[model samples]
Target: MKRYLFIMSLIALLGACAKKEGKFDRADGTAAITVASLENHLKILASDAFMGRMPFTEGEQKTIAYLQEQFKNLGLESGNGSSYLQEVPMVEITTTAAPVMEVKSAKKKFTLEGLKDYVIWTQRTDPTTEVKDTELVFAGFGIVAPEYNWNDYEGLDVKDKVVVVLVNDPGFGAEDVSLFKGNTMTYYGRWTYKFEEAARQGARGILIIHDDVPAGYGFWVVQNSWNASKLYLDTRGKDLYFSAFTGWVSQPAAKKLFEEAGIDWASTVSAARKPGFKAVPMKLSITTSLVVKAKYDKSHNVIGKITGAKQPDEYIIYSTHWDHLGIGKPDEKGDTIYNGALDNASGTAGMLELIKAFKNMENKPNRTVVFLAVTAEEQGLYGSEYYAQNPVYPREKTVANINMDGINPYGRMKDIVVVGIGQSDLEDYLDAEAKAVGRYTSPEPNPVAGYYFRSDHFNFAKVGIPALYTNTGIDHHEKGADYGKQLQDEYVSKYYHKPSDEYDTSRWNLEGAAEDLQLLFNVGKKLAFETSWPQWKKGSEFKSTREQYMPKVN
Candidate 1:
């Protein structure tokens, strides 16, 4: 009897050990992240052989092929009807330099170089466009916000005239906290909105004065972008609305324009802030013409979906921008390819991994999981904007959008930066998942730069869907925050918006990346199963939109 009991006890002990091992095994119902798999994807996506993955180029074809192949292998269904690619209509606008941009003031005249001190471009469909001697009006901020009861163009007729405006808004310089959040930029401050509003007001031309802090990047960024071929959605379907000429003026050039009008440039800006401010006529006129060739082409937004068994209609989305700055002028090293490895390729790879993990799960999620790699994000979130406007899944059914833009190539940090914090309950999900891996959430380091409005996720947020755009934490384990800041500074100064942003495995540490991916997965899994739909926190601009679409749960 004693011998029999000993044998049974030994067998039981062995069984317990096997169960423990199985609990931790990724292939056996465990949540294990394969960093090697992620690295392999990034290496291929960011490779020089990929030719920088620019839209409308050879690189775009290669990149899309690889993505489709991976999705097929992973067993995800095509998101579009009978296809993985969603065709997006685009118009490539290539403008040639006119003789010069002639500016005539009361007593002086100035000629601005085409691509040197100033860069001008337009999106109007007109083949032959000219702004001949339009009056210049200095409109402070050039914003009209019903919420704030502020309008710079309240009583001015800006039709067929040039509107010169500040880069950000009056809220940026306001002293009170209740006024536009005091220095935190709202959507009205974005350059896109500025130009769109100007077009709505029937302006002949719109010129924004560039300031480094407010515009986020330096004047060099704008110069580089304007020098390259610009792309926009075809105006054939939608009405094309824009000023005849839309561009930027450097600080000194703007000051010169103001000085030519015999107006104190600094004092005039100060005076424009008060109530009942009128448009200041600089007594100046801008004369410019453009010879533009319009070519309509089709781009794509790649989408793959894993349909849920119980709740096939409800969905959680994982998105990243696949497009980067296409081939452009060579850099100092004579390399014309902008690899955009960290800028977005890393984030794209992360989304691929998340898709794989969801596909591998034994107990399938309750809601469908959608992975979208959008095009033309580098051009200003155009692809995602189009998706938001025309969604494959209903906006009311989209539970949440987890967007990854620039992932950390460096090692792990303590706190992950959450852009547009305090906007949604999605942060609660992220906080719990991150704590599981000894990580925490933090707000954006530079809120004043308006990083929240700079990415594709902003489009979804605009339509009332709760969106989370989180970057790798900054408090590194080895080098701490200072070291992390150093890496960021290097990227911003040297490779950002340049051709040197190619991938290098020697410097990249994807451990932190894998951690963040796991955290995002956990968030999606929770949302997929939960009964309640996540809502924007009170006071958020998207709150009303969310309330309108969310299902009434009694």
Candidate 2:
């Protein structure tokens, strides 16, 4: 009897060890995320059949169906209560401006040519929007920051007038760090905010003077939107309404207007940059009318989920915007499709690859992991904004967010660049994962460009969710930063936002992309099993909101 008992006990112990080892085995799962798998998904998604993946079109239907099918095949539960799609209702605003908009002054008058000297559009859905002989007010930077003690529109009445403002904040060219986050753009510096503030001030319209140094991109970038339509989330019932017109005028055109008003352009600009600068009237009247056509439609944000075994309420979200610029004008080679192979198709494929990695793991997550592919990102982050505003899961229960906008097609890197550095503890998690694989973390080269506010991740960050956006480090593995820069410049000049953005096997190598996806997977994996909720770092604009709202979540 004693011998039999001993043998039985030994067998039980061995069985327990085997089960534990199997559950903890992490090797095969990590290997599942591979270059070939990512490439396959990327190539298929970027194919011509996808039609550039525009929202509210046949392409959107096909793209969403493909995502849903992939999730179903992987056995992922629907993230939106038995449905993978979250409908994002949006409005399309198509504005057509007259050829010549006249500018008038007491002394003399001149006409501004549309699409050349100025470009204007209307946000209102009304059939006709007018800016008829509205007086122009030079509101400096158009900022009203109580914290910075700056108010350009203080004691000014801009009603029924056009507010002409500079593109960037006053501190953009300042040498003093004390001046409004000096040289680094504050939220007030954004063009979107300019329109928002103008509406609040009861202005009829707002025109931003375009300067390449302050705007980051060149004027040609602005010129591309001469008469293009725009997509925006529908807020018809909201009390806040947008101004009738929002526009941009070239630097030379603005200077000519200043001259016509007898205001010294150089001295006026200098005074605007200093503190205590008040609004200056251009005394110039402008008249323009925009024929507006509006339509309402719905786009979908696709979501897939892996429910947790232990704590289903806690979650980690991975985000990617799946939409890109659809078919448009033909390029020199007659290619009309703006196949955004690198912009986001590559990143979306990486998210799908992550799903495979998580599914392959023997151990189920302790906290749920969510894969979210949002839409209408090319039209301005509307999809992610909708999700963030109306989250499927409570934001408090969410642990962290990892966002992939573009994966590096250049080979492996020695470092991964972090955008919006020092925003959260997510950086620590990424640093750990990168170091384990003998890579390092570095800050982005242009932190002042406000890249953190550009991608879908910004929507998550805006709602106090601790989020991280990373770029492939410019420091290449074999070559130096110069080589990496040359490649990026090529992408910008040759393919960025152009019909020639289609994938070419000769140009791209997915080894780096695969490695990037793996790193993100590890970060998500760590958060999946962990119990601690990551906090936004102190001094972050979003930290206070996180602390205030966390306890209120059910």
Candidate 3:
């Protein structure tokens, strides 16, 4: 009997030592990711049958079911207490444009054609949204940041007025590192923020002047993206605090308006950067009409979990947005489905692939890992926003979030792009994993684009959870940097958000995506087992929120 007990003790010791060695410390790549498997998943999720996976549509039902099935197949438990789905109520608004925006200046009148000179939409739930000759005030930058002691609306009541604002902030133009985090675009620089701030300031409408350098993309991107049906979380009669109209104008249109007002465009741009800059009334009124068709319904956030062996309540989240633009206006070739293959179907597949990797582990993690596929990312990140507000897991017990969106489909990269690189200690974790694969981590080439605030991870970050958002590197291993840049530029011009975004197996290199998935997996794997909570870097906007919500280590 004593001999039998000794043998059992010996077996237990070996198991404990094996666990310490790390179940994820395998050199074989198959355990983490595989190219063929990833490609197979992508083919189905981004196929035409999915119909672009639009929220509140049949595509959404198919997407949610497929995700749930994938999770169940992987043997992962439902994240939301025996239910893999979290219902998110949403409102869809399709605004029909009037083709022309009539501007009545004090001197004369001019008309700007839609899809050519400007694009307009409305967030208000009202069926008819019309701005009839509303006063146009050139609210320089339209920012009211007290940290910089700058208020463009000072002594200017923009209530019932249309505020024409510049895209991005003055710091980006001046390259003054002392002002507004230098060339790095802050939340204030985002167009979404501008519209929200305008609403808060009681503005009837907000129009952003689009310049390539400041807006990071061409006017065509704005035109194509805005000329569609938009989705938002249903406020359920709650005050949404949104402007009647939020839109953009071409640089030429903006210049024409400024010229008509006798305000030198160049001088106004320079003066807008100066301290104590005040709002200038352009003596112009914008007139436009919008007819909106609205629908309210419930969407789902598919959540699955690998509950921790020790701390079941504490969680580390892996997220990807699943919904895309759906079927929209047909392109010149008659292709109407916006198969968001790379935009997000790739990310969602990455989440599932990573979950499979974790499930294959010999030893379970100490903290829970939540694999969440959210909806309505194309419609302003509403799905993730709902999850953050009504989280199944308390924010205090949440450890970190690793988000994958628009990963590399080209080829293996020499480096990885870290979006908002200096935001948190999560960078160190990712850097370590990336280096293991002989790849270096670099900050995103275009920090001024504000790509950080544009993804699902931002919603998690906003609630003070440390989140990591990165993309596949721009420097391809064989094609080199110029080739990488050319591919990216081509996508932005020809494919992004268009029906051309459909998946083409011949054009893709799955090995690169597999590499990214492995790197992200390593980051989350380390966080799940480690006893420490990663914190936002000093001076980060979300740092205080982390300090507030994270459980005290006393």
lDDT of 2 by residue, 1-554 (tens): 99999999999988755543423233546898988889898998888899899898788898999999998998889999989999998999998888888888997778999988888888898899887888999999898876577888899998998999998887787876567667777667889878889998989999999999989988887898788889989888877668888989999999999999989999998898888888888889988899988999999999989988778998899999999888878899988888899988989999999999999886777788999999999899999999998899989888888999989988888888898787799999999889988888888777678888889988888788999999977879889765666777788799888877777788898888788778889888888877778888765656766887887423
Q: Write the per-residue lDDT of candidate 1 for residues 337-443, one digit (tens) a residue.
A: 88888878888888888888877775566678899999999887888988888899999989999999988888788878888777799998898777876788888
State TM-scores per candidate: 0.87, 0.89, 0.86
lDDT, each prediction = 0.81, 0.86, 0.86
lDDT of 1: 0.81
Clashes of 3: 0
Question: What digit string (tens of lDDT, one per residue) describes model 3 on residues 1-554?
Answer: 99999999999989876774444453432365788778888889999999999988899999999999999999999998889999999887898878898889777888988878888888777778888989898999998776577788899888889999999987886768768778899877888878888999989998899999878888987977765767788887676577888889889988998998888999887888888887888888888888888888999999999888777788999999999988988999999999999989999888888998888776787789999999988888999999998999988889899998887988888888899988999999989988887988888887888889999999999899999999878888987875666788888888899999978967888888888888888888888777788888865757767777556755
Q: If the candidates were sorted by their TM-score against the true structure, best first, what order would they fall in?
A: 2, 1, 3
